[model samples]
Target: MLRLISSIIFRLLFYRFPQLAYSQEEIEEYEKMYSKALTSKSEIKYSSNFPKLHFIQYIASTKKVVLHGSNHKGINEFEPRRQTLFNGKYEEAVFATRDGIWPIFYAVFDRNKLVGNFRNACISSDLKYNYYFFSLTRETILSNPWTSGMLYFLPEETFEKVNHSLVPFDEWISKSPVAPLTKIEVEPEDFYFINKVSYHNPKESVIVSWFLYKLRTKFFIKR
Candidate 1:
């Protein structure tokens, strides 16, 4: 009975989030990069290229690129870390991507640190593609106002490059660790949100899902 249930769950997951098949060569490369990054003892510092910035959220499905409270606006409130940034200190950044939902990826950081350089590499949950290595300094954060939270959507074309450059932020932070490493576990609900945001075929499915409609209307729909 347990085996049967396990099989059913596996099938359901596969159906909902199809596994991406990567070549053996690609898999080997990611493993190599991940191993090297994990074992490296080199000092990782934040790059000077990143500007001092902070963001509340991002909306890519619109015309005007709106950055809600970005560009070092909240740095004052983000004290201690804020001082570090001003002192030219760099925060370590780690990257990861989910399977089934290919494009929605994440770059977790050691508390208070933003993305460092753009040459580091990290591993992926799927082990299919790696994470992108990009600096998330004030300039990049202000320039690229993306939807907030752990969830992010990037173009399909850039997926490969992003994955190859995945650097483990936690690994770097471990050198002179200040905070605990964050392990982000993507939930099923997150997958649903990514799908709704990234691939919305209004003809095939309703743009405003039932849950969203309820949330939007708040039980005040008139007959």
Candidate 2:
């Protein structure tokens, strides 16, 4: 009975909020662009000068599609696997995000070259902007051999929200295997903050690094 009630509530919410539902027209247009990008050998740039939350808002308002980014290529199906987070929490799922810019970070970086990596997405105090911070060791940047990555476009049918309170519109997970409709190749230059990277010692506190990054972004907007 409770499950049925939940399903009804979800249906009501989705009906009341059209953005929560998928749009086949939007998906078709995106796939067409993806094909063009492939022929041109160019990145399908999604990064924007606006705040990250704005991108999330645009996604929720305009078109809602699940996105998964990876450093690998030629993956027809995404299998659910155990993933360990920076906080040590473990889950067996195929993870994804609705925020277009966030996935690019995962798509561009070479995971094997880094000993460790940390990232966070936060909203500003005024709630008008969003911040995304990432940390990596200097050696990781220098040693990374690959200059490109892949971004997978997925349907939202088999996905569920992961953290409704924290990132209600962004984080998602699928417990079953998912086949992507298509994928686009991307490069580091495709990310808006690609030039704003901060290399710190792995031993340093991530909190400190994040704080410094905030300051740098505030003081040095052009850099």
| CA lDDT scores, all candidates in order | 0.25, 0.59
User: What TM-score quantifies how close candidate 2 is to the native fold?
Assistant: 0.64
TM, every model: 0.24, 0.64
**Model 1 residue 91 lDDT score:** 39
* Model 1: per-residue Cα lDDT over 128-221, one tens digit each: 2222222223332333324323322112221121221222211111112121111112232333222222111233223223123323223322
Superposed Cα deviation of residue 128, candidate 2 (Å): 5.7
Root-mean-square deviation of each candidate, in angstroms?
Answer: 17.8, 9.9
Residue lDDT tens for model 2, 64-157: 4678779987788899999954445688989887656667778887777776654444222112233455555666655653467888777778
Q: Pick out the ten consecutive residues of candidate 2 with the lowest summed lDDT.
A: 12-21
Best by lDDT: 2
